[model samples]
Target: MSITQHQTEAGSGMKPVGKAKARFGTGRSEFVVVAVLYAVAIFLTVGTATMNVQGKSAPGPQFFPILVCIVLYLAATLLAIQILRKPNVPDNTVHPGHGQFSADMLHDLGHLGKEEDAAYDAAPSQTPGKTWKTYSDWRTIGLLVGGVMAFVLLLEALGWILSAAALFWLVAYALGSRRPIFDIGVGLLFSSIIQLAFGAALGLSLPPGFVGGIF
Candidate 1:
């Protein structure tokens, strides 16, 4: 096409065919995940509040969970709005055809995939280091899952103090905290604060287990 034709096309606000508009986020996957979490938060907040709390005033045992749900709701609403404002990005994933895949075809596909990956890696992203991509890594994921499991198993047996302290330390370390001793100290301090808030201030009881006498 002529230079005039190109200028005319540009002036006319015509977008190139097959090229999707850029989205604010990397993908809609994040929005979907956050949306699901938001729903869960609402459910938990409402569900837990229904539990009996005899003679307790406002902001009782259900207070903390409801607070957390509020934060989640705000975050999810903001994220959803942001995602909606941005244009939708098309999914470009390729899937295998029906029946067994051919070796030669797979080989050719792999080579092409490598080239595309290389190009993507070479290009700088618009929001480098802004997102929490590494937080979902296998090691981090394992630590989180293990910590939750351990907390559940130990909550009643070992009690809230020890179990919560361990959970805090594990999560902090998993998220890249450098000092083990410091983390442990902070973890214990945090658990103590929570215990004081609920047990002492709010007049709510927590599982004391073997340390029932002390707590």
Candidate 2:
């Protein structure tokens, strides 16, 4: 193509082969994540069902697991719906595939898939400081992992309220919550409720730890 033709095409914002670089996030990875979460939810449901109800306790040992499974199912459903509703954003210049669902939107997925297969099949992005292109966000991931580790290490010593509150706070921070005081308060409230639910509603006594023992 001539330089004039190339300039016109660039100005018009339409590539020759109908493929463009992704601007916003593509949902293919998110869809895979949703599928994985749904599978996990299903497995947890089956496991909870097959658990040996050895005690006469009301709600049994499976009660909390059932509640967790319900939450996971609901969360996965919402995420899948969001991904389906979100249109492909291969290019932000002309806002292609931004309208409601249509054939062109589906084409965007296939086009991106072909491009990825051709380009990323052999290796990830070779950009500086980017180890892998499929995913990143290592900072937020590290924060969450650290939070889980802290919860595990502190649960027995600090009790469910403090340990779980710390986990909640870290998670909130990782997810972009900036107000530490309010987030910590909310975390404490949630942890306290979980503790109460476990103790009163389920008749399970978690470790009281130093705070509760002092009081």
- Superposition TM-score, candidate 1 onto the true structure: 0.61
- Cα lDDT for residue 8, model 1? 100
> How does model 2 fare in lDDT?
0.74
Model 2 clash pairs?
none
Clash totals in order: 0, 0
The sequence of per-residue lDDT tens digits that candidate 1 reaches over residues 1-215 is 79999999999999888955554565555677677878888798878878787775776777787788888888888888777776344333332221234334556666445565455566535323332112237999899999999999889998888899889889989999988899889888988788888877678777887888763
lDDT for every model? 0.73, 0.74
Summarize candidate 2's per-residue lDDT along 23-99 as a digit string, tens digits.
Answer: 54564467777887899999999999898777688777788899889999999999878877784433222222223
Tell me how candidate 1 scores on lDDT: 0.73
TM-score of 2: 0.60
C-alpha lDDT (0 to 100) for residue 95 of candidate 1: 25
Model 1 segments more than 4 A misplaced: 1-26, 56-59, 84-136, 213-215
Q: Pick the candidate with the highest lDDT.
A: 2
- What's the C-alpha lDDT at position 4 in model 1? 100
TM-scores of all candidate predictions against the true structure: 0.61, 0.60
Candidate 2 worst ten-residue window by lDDT: 89-98
